[model samples]
Target: MKNYKISAIATTKIPPERIFAVLDDFGSWPTWMPSFERVKVDLPTNPVPHLNYQFRLRGSVVYADMQVIEYTALSRATSFRINVPPLTGVNRCSIRPLSQGRYRIDRIDTIDLPKVVVGVLDATQRARFSRLAQEFLTALLRTAEMRG
Candidate 1:
């Protein structure tokens, strides 16, 4: 497996709680997330470790199963495991409080792609996922701003 990380950050003049509120609502992600097509939730609305959910991302019709392997509220961070083949790793989201009532939203993806597929789509996937990350951040920022 080839491991790689891509990150994106967006700063906003809103409280971290406001942003976290939006981020915590996993069921509502497809509505605002850039590449999310839909989510099939089998657990409660509130998130917890080990909870499973399936989501379909735009540009791909397959809905991958995912699990919340870590949810640390005190630090405002959560890590998800992609429980599917061909691709695996963690997608971590976090909120950082800043001065002046501003907050920084971060989405960091640690993707482990299969070696055979890595070299074939390495450059293309990196660029595509990077763009998607930025777009996701922009959408999250806008959604939080409007809510705040």
Candidate 2:
């Protein structure tokens, strides 16, 4: 198996608290994240630590159990995948306050997977993941701003 780190960062004119609100509401992910078909959370509201979730990815047969390992209000969150073949990760997301009510959003996934699975990802798959992450951040900002 090989270890891979995938990350995406986005800067927006949205407040960190607003961005964090979206992150805390795990059930709202499917409304914006294009890669997510459905997200079933153990809790309907805040992302409680140690809570498990079932994710259904769009256009993909892969299903995984994601457990919330850490969550800090308006700051950071980390999750781990369990019982998934050829894929597992400590996925972390963070929001930082910037100048003029702007905030920086970051998502990182440190994954361990078989070499063959990594090889199959090629440039296209990698680019797609990056794009999705970017879009996810943008949509999150929009959703948060709209709520204010």
Candidate 3:
């Protein structure tokens, strides 16, 4: 098996709770998250460890499953195990206060790809994951800032 690790970081003036609020709302993901034609969650909101959600890829029949494996409300941190067929991902998003009215948001993803298919496409997928992580952070910040 081959592993690909990626981290996306950015600074924002929004509060941690505000940013986290957007994450808690799965229904709103389609507005910001790319490739998510539809999302389904067993719980209403406020994700905690063990909570699960699923999303259908846009223009595709594939359905991805994501399960929350860690969550810290006070720290505004959450981790998930994402399974989308041949590849499995462990993704974490966290927010830390940087200064007064400033904070940093990070999205770290580690994808375990099969060794057999870990050739040229591996690089492409890594790049894709990095883009998605960065995009997720940017969208989350935008959504949170717009809400308040």
Sorted by TM-score (best first), the order is 2, 3, 1
Deviation (Å) of 25 in candidate 1: 1.1
Q: What is the TM-score of each candidate against the true structure?
A: 0.74, 0.75, 0.75
Candidate 2 C-alpha lDDT tens digits along 3-120: 8777888888777767777776666767765656554444434434333543332224445555666666555555555453536777777877788877778888788878888889
Ranking by lDDT: 2, 3, 1
Whole-model lDDT for model 1 versus the true structure?
0.66
- Backbone clash tally (model 3): 0
Give each model's clash number. Answer: 0, 0, 0
What C-alpha lDDT, on a 0 to 100 scale, does residue 100 get in candidate 3? 75
Error of 1 at 22 (Å): 1.1
lDDT of all the models against the reference?
A: 0.66, 0.67, 0.66
Question: Which consecutive 10 residues in model 3 have the weakest lDDT in total?
Answer: 50-59
Instruction: Give me the runs in candidate 3 sitting further than 4 Å from their true place.
Output: 38-60, 74-84, 122-125
- Per-residue alpha-carbon lDDT of model 1 for 53-144, expressed as tens digits? 33333223434455565555522333444434446677777777788877777888887777786678767778998998899878877888
What's the CA RMSD for each of the models? 3.7, 3.6, 3.7
